[model samples]
Target chain A: MPVYNARIIVTLRSSILDPEGTAIEHALHELTYTSCTNVRVGKYITMNVEAESEENAREILDQACRKLLANQVMEDYSYTLEETEREPA
Target chain B: MPVYNARIIVTLRSSILDPEGTAIEHALHELTYTSCTNVRVGKYITMNVEAESEENAREILDQACRKLLANQVMEDYSYTLEETEREPA
Candidate 1:
């Protein structure tokens, strides 16, 4: 079985108000950190899973996102999966 | 000035309801991804900053978390900073 690494990102829909992001930006200005901008709040989920193939992993991950991971009405999600690194002998 | 990389994680305070995480868990079960459990939703923010010292970076990050990045009533946050990686010749 091949081990797959997945990075899942979930963010509030554009229509939603992200008080968290807004607050962080304000604090940055107060600290004299002017270079930071466009702060957004979202989830970054890293998962390692065993799967027979990439297609199978994608199928399973999609199901997870739609059913358990993201809310259709208020949140949007995207994910990327890569094969696990192998150690050199 | 040294460049610092910060990873900010924001989670819903225990008292808050996380429908988003709940939904993701439910979806995972349906997709036959049984190994995953205790799924939670949070933000992972990556920032590259130029700071004179670690203390200064911490102060700014803290201010950002309080004023803009997190909701005190419902959210909590933690951050870690490491010096940026240098390119190898």
Candidate 2:
């Protein structure tokens, strides 16, 4: 089976509070960066899936996102897929 | 302060076990996708940071990643910085 790499981005909706992000923003000011402003936080994921075609890859990816990769309630996710020349780690 | 959007990706090193990824991979085969193979999971975070320049943004982002975005023991992180024409949410 061919291997495909998927990069998934998950982020909290704009309305939610990000305590960590806020703290980091404050830390920047302490670091002497007065220009620093609002900061929001999120996550980045990379995964490899086996599939014969892009459509198949998409199908597999959708399953992965729905079942495990994303939490649909507070965070929203989007993914990009690419074929890999080397085998997945 | 100018607003910039930073996309952060944090993943466990290749040697670590990912239970959620494994479960999702298994579910793919259950969904009739036998071709699916190794799947790794990680987080994709999108954040808005206020900074005057890419260099300044990077300085702030490094602090953010070290302080909050990533767990140093198990995860490694990388980020991309981009300017947003619209105000951050």
The root-mean-square deviation over C-alpha atoms between each candidate and the true structure, in angstroms, is 8.0, 4.0
Q: In model 2 chain B, which range of ten residues has the least summed lDDT? A: B31-40
Indicate the docking level reached by candidate 1: incorrect
Q: Write out the backbone clash pairs for model 2.
A: A42-B45, A43-B43, A43-B44, A43-B45, A44-B43, A44-B44
Runs in model 1 deviating more than 4 A are A1-32, A35-42, A45-89, B85-89
| TM-score for the B chain of model 2 | 0.89
Error of 1 at A73 (Å): 22
The C-alpha stretches of model 2 lying farther than 4 A from their native spots are A13-43, A66-75, A86-89, B86-89
Question: Scored by Cα lDDT, where does model 2 land?
Answer: 0.74
**Share of real contacts kept by model 2?**
0.58
For candidate 2, write residues A1-89 as lDDT tens digits: 67788877777877888887787667756766555566666766666767778898898778766776567877777889888886546
Task: Residues A1-89, candidate 1: write the lDDT tens digits.
Answer: 67677778878887888787677667777777775554557786656656788888788778777776677788888888898863354
DockQ values per model: 0.23, 0.44
Candidate 2 lDDT tens digits, B8-89: 7788877788887787678767876666577667766666767678888898778767776678888888888888886546
